[model samples]
Target: MNIVVVGGGLAGAHAVQELREQGYPGDITLLGEERHLPYERPPLSKGLLLGTEEVQSIFVHDQEWYADQQVDLRVGTSVTALDLDRGRVHVGDHPIAYDRLLLATGAEPRRLPILDALEVPVLCLRTLDDATALKSHLAGRVLIVGAGWIGLEVAAAARRAGADVTVLDTAALPLLAVLGVELAALFADLHREHGVDLRLETSVVEADGSTVTLSDGTRLNPDVVVAGIGATPRDTLAARAGLATGNGVLVDARLRTLDPHVYAAGDVANHDHPTLGRLRVEHWDNAIEQGKHAARAMLGDDQPYDRLPYFFTDQYDLGMEYVGHVGPDGYDEVVVRGDRERRILTAFWVRNDRVVAGMHLNDWDAMDSIRQVVGSPRSQAQETTARP
Candidate 1:
């Protein structure tokens, strides 16, 4: 049996590695769009951009691992079309037949319509090349659009590179749409302390050369601008193959597509969670777990991907680990424990008295205890206000 995994990102690479480790004697082939082997991307804007870590530290595995494990790792080759009926993927001129196919096609950075007209390069950190290009503009004036994780991390890196950094977000608070206002305030505070000119309720109106005019009529001259806006799922191949897609490739609980022969995981897959309903997670932990989960499901295991969504972020001296799911509307109220001033606390979002999601701001020891009762109803004692 031949297994073909598309998009040689962390998820696809882990899927192949897990399949081989689990005693699958089938021939495995992994395809990546980039020349580099499968590498972890989280560090690209953080330690890697800051020059704190080397390139070798970010790779999923060395080049020799593919040959030793009998896995064909094809780099710089793209799978443009998926022929579902014939069980084959169109890779350039040739079509590779597969018994089972895993679509780990990752997401691409979303670009603003104004970027096309701009003479200066407006970057987004998604792949290694994107990071490398953005790295060259370091130590210059950086006008970062969006105040999300990518934007904040890039701002942090740029500041470390001695660049004049200014972050602009249309939201009244940073991460307002995702983490809500209070936590967003905490992150905003962290950046402000680190000498970042954090601008909120700001929108990009026009981009001419290196000058970006804001909606408030404020013109700023930045050597380079980065739009850390979000990502769109790379699901054109799956759609061409007639697979269901919403925000991403829609898959059932087992990470199986409408066609049994095809499966998708990671950022490209909008998985239907047991508790969270249909949601697409674009974090590291989900990619690793879902890839393994999808591979197990393909190998005859029927257990659903029931693990609660988890994500973490680090900026300056602040570190956060958030677990559980927070819906689009967000929770009713936030409860805090410990001290925000001391930077050791846990914040929980209560919806109808049940703790839907919880985040620890510098408190590393509370992860296990927080995970135990994350979905459970919160009591009155746990509703006290604490600092961050």
Candidate 2:
């Protein structure tokens, strides 16, 4: 059987590797729009932006490895259309037929509508080219729009690079969407302690050249501006092809789309999760794990992709990790270990005596236990917290 995987991001690359490892000896084609080899994206904002690692080191595998796996790797090729009935994908002037196809077309950064008015260069660290440009543009003062993970990460990197970093967010606290108010407030303090001038509950009204005007009528001039508001899943391809789509391309628990022959994984897929219901995760771990699961399902070994979602962000010497969905309704019980003042603690979200979600800050040991609790159907109320 011939399989074609579109988009050479983490999910697409992992799917190709997993398919080969699963002993699928048929023709496999990996198509990438980028001219460079498939590389890790997380580091683009962290290590690469900080100049700690070389760009070439981020690749999952070298060119020689692709040849060894006998997978046809097509770089710099854009998939124009997907002919579902014919089982063919159009790439510019060429077309490739496949028995099965995996759509892993990740996400793109949400650009500012007033980007054209900005006089100074605004950096976005989504791709290799973005990182390269942002790295070169780093200067005296760096203004970061949005206080999300990507924005905070870039702020951390730019701060480390000797740039006076300022982060602005419309929410009351940074990461409020994910960590709730209490936890997000602590995160806000962490950034402030690290010299990040974080402006909360603030909106960017406009940008003129090097100056950004706030909704409150405050203006700040910076050498560079980086916007990491968030990402929108690249679902146009799937939506255009008549596939089910909501916030992202809708897929079943097995990672198969409405079309049996077509499947999706990674950031672009809004999977019907076993526990959480429907979710479209953009984390690195989810992309890799889901890609493997989709490949396994494609090989007739159907298995539900129900792994606990986990993600981490490095900011100012703190390793912050989170597991499960921290819904917006707030947690019933919050358990804390260590001191939030010291920036070392693990906050557990309990609902009905069960640990539904957890956020770990500089607490790696608690991750496995937290994962176990999230994975099992154990109630938080069942376990008593021993006083120290």
Task: After superposing candidate 1 on the true structure, give the runs of residues whose Cα lies further than 4 Å from its correct spot.
Answer: 380-388
lDDT of 2 by residue, 271-305 (tens): 99887788899999999998889899899877788
List candidate 2 segments past 4 Å from native: 328-330, 375-388
Candidate 1 C-alpha lDDT tens digits along 259-297: 998999999999989888999999989999998988888
- Pairs of residues at least 3 apart in sequence or in different chains that clash in candidate 1: 340-387, 340-388
Q: Could you tell me the lDDT of residue 111 within candidate 1? A: 90
Q: After best superposition, candidate 2 residue 386: deviation in angstroms?
A: 12
TM-score of 1: 0.97
lDDT of each: 0.88, 0.85
